[model samples]
Target: MADIRIVDVSLRDGNQSLWGAVGLNSAQIFQIAPVMERVGFCALDFSSSTHMGMAVRTDHEDPWERLRVTHQLMPNTPLQFIGTGLRFISWESQHPEFMQLAYDRLVANGIGRFVVLDPMHDEQAIMETARMFRQAGCKEIIGALVYTVSAVHDDAYYADLAGKMAASPNIDRVYIKDPSGLLTPHRARTLIPAIRARLAGKALELHSHCTIGLAPLTYMDAAELGVDVLQVACGPLANGSSLPSAERVIANLRELGHKVDIDDRALRQVCDYFTRLAKVEGRPAGKPQDYDASFLRHQVAGGVMSTTRRQLSELHLEHRFDEVMAEVTRVRAELGYPIMVTPFPQMVCTQALYNVIGDERYSNVADQLIRYALGRFGRPTTPIDPDVLDRILSRPRAAELMHEAEALPLKEMRKKFSPKLSDEEFILRATMPADQVDAMCKKGASKRHYNPEAAGLVKLLKALGERPRQSRVFIQQPGLTLDIRSAAKEAN
Candidate 1:
């Protein structure tokens, strides 16, 4: 049996996939650190700029401290950071110096590896990002060949791209990031080998979502096709739109005569803990998905879909979802079918939302979309629809964006924030709103431990105690019992 390694993504991709990126906090992750360390994963899909930004925006947790502490607790496992070499926190891209500092601070706070991706699949940009990470002393750098379904994206395209990436000195490996789960087993048979042929001895990894119900099957094909690593998630975080479940993938690999050198006992604990945590938080656990053919048309990723729905709900326009989705497919094609990954997906969704809600199409063009027309992100896979491009560029806003200011350089950027701010704090405060960063600082560092089982039980006890009229209480289950009596009632 040939051996296949695993990289756990429960804390990052799975959390973002199933819970809108707010699922696991620092304490919850810390609770499983040692067990996860023992599970023998090559790395943890640790965090993204969005995930870290949300730490301050939604949870008021200091993500830097979280990573620092996690590194201390799980000293043996490498923590992976994913970046597009474009921007941090904000949707707009940043200057190279800004991104360089961001990457350097990440390495300082325990980010050992970087998954360098460029949403536009720009090889030059990807190589540049990989070099920046290398200069920051990143232990490993994996170039991402983002997979998408389009007339231009094919086996040869990926193979050629992988060859270029392998030629770069800074990139240690290449991974097929199937965010939309569009890779079928049929595609993998040819695509995997084609890419591997040009990898030039660097390892190949497969990271696919279960969005369209094909990733699990595609993963098996990947294993047989000699993918060196399979990125999987634990229970409650796997399946559905996330990656394949580690438990299921391991068992399947073993039955296929492949050796998976992992601790099953610790894996079960990891699964059980996440399952319990999901239930306690009243969060939906990922379930196996059905084949959805419509996914091919839009290729909108799971997280983008989730975020779109949330944003629509916030705007009290939830009922326009189907309309918005239809507009998304149309907008993507008109915009030259850019790969539906970070930034591009956001741009498409925003334009679609505007089209659906406005009186006329292209009535409210997003600055990002306008910038794309001006050749800001990269050359689109195909020329944009002429009419749409004209309309996008004709807008007065587009004219102003044409002469947009460049991002601040490192020394100049430092002038905007207090000199007292550390690199971590300075980056956060500069990229995010000052209020959000201040609120995170006010919350203090997150505690380092979490007891999943005790969470719900403690809430129950607190609820029962709030009832002044209640004197005594008793509870029993198949394997346990608990009884409580008020002091006043006992005295009576």
Candidate 2:
């Protein structure tokens, strides 16, 4: 089995990357930690130190409380956390040694490992940061080079940077941080090995984003090149704006004859949880937009279209969707900016096209929107479709209908809704005490958890430390009422 460590950044990177606006709550992190541990992740990038700079409560933003809660819930699993060294701790601050203080607190609170990502301001500062971590008794340091790939440079520059990272005595592991998902798989396959060769005895890691849809392949190539660790995101956090999924990569790698010792079951459970979470958050879930040149540039340049859409919505810009797209086109043209043919632009154009009075020419308009956005248009012309535009414009309550229609299949839907059950009640319902069905629903069984699969019911029951009783029966939908008396009797 090839030695591969799974470091799940769902709580830290995943949350910050996607849910930065709302920030993750302690409740959500508490719900996810055991699932991550159960899935056999080597570490959790629990929370970032960056939260201190942002004005938010620890409960609202910092994941420390959740990490502590998870420790209480699953005491057996070792917890690992991360801190970035990029932001400067204010010298005039109330707490003078903020960085060291944050570092000490995490270590004191059971975080066994740490990752130090340097700021874009300075590269060599990583050496000093690592030394400070070592002085503070930090073990297992991952010396991360952040946003290095975004620099206008050639392959040789990247190779030389890797070599500098390897030669740093303060660092334990050297990681190539694609703060933007710009590294193509072919690039990763070539570059990761070059870095690995430079750091023959030291740990080499790769961190890529799914913004360009190349993260999974990059992970595979990293594995092939003897990379030590690969950062991953679980569930909906796995693509578009998140990292490649650890579960998918491990499965693919194992199939290809290399071994990675991550727990597949845990990964799936975590993914299920996050997918549900994303739906609740009103963001698109699952694998990200397809990779292309435009998307890569967007990610590299720190584009804000995803965030921009939210801002536009808050300002009630839906009525001006077409105008907004026209503005997008105008700005791009004026600055010679590149827009990729990614799903986001398509979605934006769709919204714009939806608002315009559709003529047959509108289809061509949409096509041209895509072509021009991708920098491929020689003479992009507008096309329109009258009926299509009429259907879009005349439709009443279209947004509401669209929102309600985004549900997943029942089988998949059961994962996220926590039946309002008290912890005890959840155990009883999940255990399938047969007679407990009505009581379970009445006691707060979330509507989403009512599965027809007796097997899943049994597994869940077992996970909750309950043994199945004879009342474990598969009830077909819209059929027989659950027999409570008989099931209760069996349970007793």
Candidate 3:
């Protein structure tokens, strides 16, 4: 088995999730780097070459001066930064040379480890990028398979792919990157072993999101299968868009007879520091309650909820809480409720329940709902009962629910969830008004119902009159606000 490693991707992936969250000064990166290194992370997934251009254009100086400072902060921990094979936005195309320029500049610095992020799942592109990096003298190159899933096949297919990927001479490591947090435990157990079998003499790492709340368990399974490295985010910034917890995973692995040398106490302090920072930054310290199981199902079923409070307010669907609840049930039947894919679904579902049952019983109802969902779905460790639900629903929120019920579409709602048809059928069924579908496609550059195929939708929407909703999906609290240099002095 390859020796285990941990790469703290909080700076790169963590910051990417947070909106306006990446302007941290060098001192900030420096401050966080040691804590991570002390916790036994092998490298820092520093920042993105794609987003770096934003900092570069906005500032007169090099935006990654913070990364240089991070080097000093973590003199020992290697720096592993990201380079993308595809640009996320058309805006990047406006400066077509940014990708190569960014790669050159990042390498010019002391960055030793590079994650060639192939968002399109194009192994050929990754191979070409690997060639370029090898030519650039980057010895430790990681090829990332972003949003990768073997759902279409069984473990054997994934294992075969891993073996083939391991044979690449230029690639040092293969990171199974699941940006959407979709990997399941059963699948992990099956696939990890298969991949290990194929890569018996090669290095393999697993980088996944906890979207389905499976990170902790999945990490354990991967370790058991002899994964070389795992990714993690530090703390409260830890869960939402962050990777699985490193200390927890390492500790769990050690208990299961694996050798890992992580400082648990230091990890705790780092978690505390970021938790406190999140509060100071005006983002809630704890995970948001609105993203419970129901909300996760909504997303999984290709249902998109408006994150803008204004849009939600305009819907005025409060009075129709029961109807929305009915819709939730129907959609669940169609797509499986508590899809249990999102680790934080309970947070969103609780908010949705609050809107349904009102504040009077919101907590109790939410608790019962989540508990029931968990138990029903085989995660019965969390305590929840209907009696407790009854108690918490007796407060002021009950009245709030009654008031909001007036605006809800009690009559127009569908009563049953049906299997999703073809791409055209999904768009026609999921969205209202053909014009709205076109408008949304134009805005998001994605198909109306498909999250992955939204490139065209994102562009079309931008071309038309609508703007894509600000993606707050993977953002952190205590968001980065200033350019790197300004934040450096501010941090000091």
How big is the positional error of residue 47 in model 1, measured in Å on the Cα after superposition? 0.7
Candidate 2 residue lDDT tens string, 336-452: 332222323444444444434334323333433333333222221122233443443344443333333322332333344365644322322322333434442344311112122
Off by over 4 Å in 2: 21-23, 51-63, 72-80, 86-96, 147-152, 277-283, 296-303, 306-492
- Model 3 Cα shift for residue 454 (angstroms): 44
Cα deviation at 375, candidate 1, in Å, is: 3.1
Candidate numbers sorted by lDDT from highest down = 1, 2, 3
Q: How many pairs of residues collide in model 3?
A: 59
lDDT (10s digit) by residue, model 3, range 1-492: 335677776666665554344534333455556676676678877766434443333322233455565676677778887765533212112122333444555566667788876433346666766776776677698766443332233566556656766788877777777765666677777777777787747777888766556667778778777778888876665555456765566667777777776677877877776655554444432132222354333443122232323334566754664455454443233222223223333344444545454554334454334333333223221223445434544546544443433211312222232444332223132223345434433443211121212333345445543423332222123642322123334465
Tens digits of per-residue lDDT, candidate 1, 1-492, equal 568999999999999989989988889988999899999999999999999999899889999998999999899999999997768988677889989889999999999989988877877788889999999999899999999988878899999999999999999999999988999999999999999999989999999999889988898889999899999999999998899999999999999999999999999999999999999989899999999998998887776888999989999999999999999989998988899876788999999999998999998987778889998887787799999999999999988998989887889989988899999999998889999999999999798778876788888999998999999889888876999989998888
lDDT (Cα) of model 1: 0.91
Give Cα distance to truth, residue 155, candidate 3, Å: 3.3
- The CA lDDT of each predicted structure is 0.91, 0.54, 0.53
Instruction: Tell me the alpha-carbon RMSD of every candidate.
Output: 2.6, 16.0, 18.7
Top candidate on TM-score is 1
Off by over 4 Å in 1: 301-327, 353-363, 476-492
List TM-scores for all candidates, in order: 0.93, 0.58, 0.57
